[model samples]
Target: MLQDTIKAQLKGYLANLAHPVVLEASLDDSAPSREMHELLHEVAALSDKVQVSEQGVATRRPSFVIRRADATGQGMAGVTFAAIPMGHEFTSFVLALLQVAGHAPKFSDDVIAQIRALPGKYAFETYVALSCQNCPDVVQALNAMSVLNPNIHNTTIDGALFQDEVAARNIMSVPQVYLNGEPFETGRADVEQILAKLDADAPRRAAERLKDIAPFDMLIIGGGPAGASAAIYAARKGLRTGIVVERFGGQVMDTDGIENFISVKETDGPKLSAALEAHVRQYDVDVISSQRASELFPAAQPGGLHGVALESGAILHARTVILATGAHWRHLGVPGEEEYRNRGVAYCPHCDGPFYKGKRVAVAGGGNSGVEAAIDLAGIVAHVTLLQRGSHLKADKVLQDKLYSMPNVTVLTEALTTRIEGNGKNVTGLTYRGGDGADHHLDLEGVFVQIGLLPNTGWLKGTVRLTDFGEIVVNDHGATSIPGIFAAGDATTTPYKQIVIAIGDGAKAALSAFDYLIRVPATGEKHAAVLETAAK
Candidate 1:
């Protein structure tokens, strides 16, 4: 009876209010229980004006249908609630309603209209840390997107909510957005980037019309040695595997020759990549190239974890994900560096060294990579100049000794490359500053930059743990701190960054992922059965 009284009062309050009413539920009130029950009926009656649903509680279908109808109506006009928005997400939820109501502080009408036209159901969940200043912008962008498409529902969960839905997803940071239960965008995403994701995730007519389907077994990002190797091993083990890469070979595409890969005496990088691709293709692996992974998120819940998202704008679902994007060499931003790239300037000496054979080349940097490249090139090239910006070389004593012993190698201490001198077609030479503050010019055919490498983990912010240098930190078994997500290859913080080591790490990661799948024991029964049959 008390519940009935409070429900009447609440309805009267909402009916008379000039603006949308915001109510905070209090767990301490005995009247709240009665009020909540009574409120549900009142909310159902007001279904034409407002919508309400509980997140943690199991609600009845009639109540939910009424709430959804009201929500959809409000959504058409740009108004909706997060139902459980708290902590850092509280502000975002309110802002989302305002943006949907066409009251957003930012964003133009054109962007909003484009978002509204987007097809398919999209669930956008953003995980954010309280300290992120740019998070509001992301929220605004999402709200604008919601305004464009009422089907796009945006949910902002604070870092603490990991105890609920996010903990199961294994999300590590804030401002991490998940679409349809998969991590979509981490950190700040611009309007264009978000729209691109929506386009990628919009399903085809056939997929859109379908109701129920099974998720993928494995989703491998990057088609390099690690990704390809993972796909091959997983497929051989009878798991349905899918691989997505911006390009087939990754950084290895630029590699001209690779002598260190085991069993193969010496082969070109492209050939090795092609062979790996063919090996995986012979199995059940689905290879997708010229596509980039734009997002990753948790799929199911509790024990078994899986998720899906897009590369560019194509939505893909998978049970497991292996990130093997690999590492990219840091570039020295100088004039003509881009034009001379692949012609006279290169990052990988092992890949492009043969082209500079019998010609003068300058190796930049003072680290082990530079010294090693210089030593290796001294044997093949006619002359090599090791340029060190520091006063002394930073390589180990053994490499330093080897560099000194090379007759054709010239050590230029405190030498800093100022410009890459090259014609429109090819490199001719370079200018540098010597230790004595004197300018020096080297007439060279190639400039091999053996500087440090940067892992492709920038997109992972707020989603996974990263080292100070931005490499993904993994355990001994290649398992990242984020459960169900494994990383390998040069992108990891492992000591050895060689092709052989990367392959070994890839194998370990694949095995670790397999173990995770086994522990879950939910979906892969067919795969396990297939494996057993093959063994027999």
Candidate 2:
């Protein structure tokens, strides 16, 4: 009965089914089985080409199979839904049914060939939450891949239902894919990335090739807008520059709004990241992606070169190293925070705030980010509650004044969030303790955690001069205490952590490094003076 409206919608979609499609829902003693059975029957009654059946049990609990029905009504297992496909995943489920009835869109010749050539039978299990905006793209891509290759089977599972499996796999985020029972990838990726992960020899070969690279004239340590800007600048000057990044896009990848990026207004994170990467690729910048820097070795002398060691055991040498490794949002480690992430608990308000329109929400942090988020959400949401663990709000007085001015905003200082209360589906409320040792509960549909910024400079702790908070300390020129090392972006002591500010800092670091390379001579080498004389 809960899915009655969805069933009616699915019936409308199945009306034009040209070929027979059979659906088999595996039932158990669970209540979900009865719900699925009723929904399946409702769907079957709509189209003569549609058939529904039931099985006793399946390898995965609460499973359903969709296949092309033959003349005798028998069908082979084609695609499986390990959980009920609802919310964003419902669109993917509908597409899969249409594809089963010979209404699938045609893919490129190259892509089809590659999928068809994939060797052996590989089972792909994609874990997804109901509210993730990016999960649908990944699920649809996998569905198409499954259609192209019979040897490859794709199963979609709702992360909420299979809590044991999620915890066992340590899945903190959604849209995670497991191939043949091994962790393959997390987050949304293009078709090429999926294929690369499926290739057994691709990773080994790529690592071996990365280990053979020569020393670069300039090296950028991250791949955010800052690193991208630095790489573009250095490469334009004909410097051999390389950017090493765990994920090309850095913190900007998780950002959702880009109204502040100058000259261009109203863009999202993924699009801007793509543009940044594309611009860098236009030049000869060696974009070394999916690599994390673990250790930094400063040069013994000026122009001698520094060394950066990656977690993959590949060491890279550079004349100058610009640290652009951006920071991650500090998460609230309370119970249900991780469990309900993207379900109702979100970090970036710009990314997930629109989903909470007209819903009551809580901002868990009274700092600048938290206060700003509250001010931003007050106009959109039904109500806003700002919770701070400290005795007073850590935000600027101006921001505090603005938040107080909002009619829908409520501030609670000296409040510590103890637990986020949510059903397995989504967050329902939050429990916190006040300064008086009294506990309080707030009914809320969403929670935004924005306490403070933590720079991604732990690796440079002993290598360079860092502040007490572990942020890399740099001068106006973005130059660190080490001559050949510079830092920029959120990792540095830059006052503002905005994207535009980071880009400007990146340019400054690149120019400063270039100036140093031209003016200072290496130990036991004297090319700098000769080059200076030639310039004169």
Candidate 3:
């Protein structure tokens, strides 16, 4: 029976085989030849999955033949083959295989039942790293899911084979999946994540829901210190201010206690964030939280200004934009990192340090932030273990001296955190092994990672030029290479990421934006009025 099933699946795949057609195009042409090159590369990756007749011509035959163990020679039970399944439509290929394999799709009862019961169009694309050991499980799971519902079309791709395609689509990591050309998940995601993506990507059926959004005088893209400062100043200027943030407090929310922020004697991160939100609300600032800006484009032809598109399908038109989208804390990328986050594990000392005031806490990284956080937390926290992956601390002498002077602060050089242990919801402690082979687990309430930050500018690919370090390059007045689109705060290559520095830069960007708008009218209202009078 198994052999018969395998043979049946193989026959289905063989019947759908397609011969790949290649076209030679010049790079110096007016047309988009680059797109063709990407398609060719995608085809090449499937060379192993399909039978090749020529250099670029391949008969898209079943790449693999599967047979059931119990089937007889006359009748085939189970068999399957995968063709070139990558790029934007890779998920469809996966679904096709699942149908042939004769297995129900692996999804929740509601989703599976809905797919089985309803009659509608469902499209999806899944990207996966072929070399990744964990990818096949996800692929098989998704295949099972596709089989349960005939309406769903799934596409799969070998992530490594399509470098140009990945680059064009701005994919950073795999299994970086997408639905309907928008982001879905990245790296070893579960079924729930995929389901959530499907729900989010579902098209809206109502036209009346779409309203004419008002153009903003200034649209800030982050809710961190930089974005908040920009929003405050821009609102004061009486411009229609709007701040779009994926998270309200940005990386600062991870901090336990913020002592560096000017004027605040001693404050926690949540309190500071609340205050900022309240202050912005007092003005005419419209703060939209938990929404990411997916794309940015010129508002008018000939580069009049820029507009932003949010993940929620909201279109934001603005005369000026301040990209205060700050940076995110670097992670250890080790096991249990995600599981321990916000429990006993944390990214900011300013945000979570107070919770470990009487208990022990570990601070990873030896940089300035690490040193500063350790020094500040040493006074309040009972014991502080500063774990440095390197041999030495990369902070200033004064800060280093203060840290060493504290009897409770123990600087562990060449130490790396391998795993974090927690009590389900919160972190209980951590396990670390030194370069010298000394393993230790300290009983602690929290762990603060003070590693450097990575700017959240991955979405700015092709739209804006960034520095080598992925930071948005801007001039002294926060004017980006693209006019009318300025950037401030940590996301920009403006050196310091301190609150005071970010505030000053934010103000400068606002003033510069105001100046640019006066010189270049975005709506062409003044020019249109002049033309109308001239016609009269």
**In order, what lDDT does every prediction score?**
0.64, 0.79, 0.62
What ordering of candidates by TM-score runs from best to worst?
A: 2, 3, 1
Question: Which window of 10 residues has the lowest lDDT sum in candidate 1?
Answer: 58-67
Better of 1 and 3 by lDDT: 1
lDDT of 2 by residue, 1-536 (tens): 43668767777888767688888778787877776777667667877888887862567768887887762322235568877776667788888887777675455465567677888887889988765656766787787787667777788987767778875775546677888898787777756567766776544555566766888889999998889889998998899899997666787776655788898879767667868888998999887766788888777678776778776557777888899998988888999998898678877665456567688999999987899899988987999999999999989899899999999999999999999998787889999999999999999999999987788888777779999988899999999999888988888899988889998988989988888877887553323332232234
TM-score per candidate, chains pooled: 0.50, 0.65, 0.51
lDDT per residue for candidate 3 within 1-536, as digits (tens), equals 12445445544553443322122222322222334344334443443333222222122221222222222441221222222334222333434433443434544455565445545545455655533323443455455554455455455554344445655774433455565677656544434345545554432311112225567778899987778888988888788888987656666654555677777789755467657777777898876655688777654442343567666565566778899888877888877778766446666554334445487888898988899989878987899999998889999898898899999999998898888887776667888888888888877767887789999998887767798889999998898877778999999999978767877888888888877767775662212322232234
Residue 67's C-alpha lDDT in candidate 2? 81
Q: Could you arrange the candidates by lDDT from highest to lowest? A: 2, 1, 3
Question: Which consecutive 10 residues in model 3 have the weakest lDDT in total?
Answer: 202-211
* lDDT for each residue of candidate 1 in 1-536, tens digit (9 for 90 to 100): 22566456545544543234222222222443444445444544642334443442322111111122223353453323322333333355445434433354454454555576787787776655433433554665675666566676564444432335544664433456788877688655656567756676533321332223345577788888888888888888888788876555566654545777888899765567657767777898766544566555543352343443443334555657788989888888877788776567876665345445588999998898898889878987999998989889999898899899978989988888989997666789999977788878889888998878889878777666899988988999888776678888988888877777877887888888888887875643223322232244
Residue 532 in candidate 2, Cα distance off native in Å? 36
TM-score of 1: 0.50
Tell me the deviation in Å of residue 185 in model 1. Answer: 30
The Cα error of candidate 1 at residue 463, in Å, is 1.5
Clashes of 3: 36
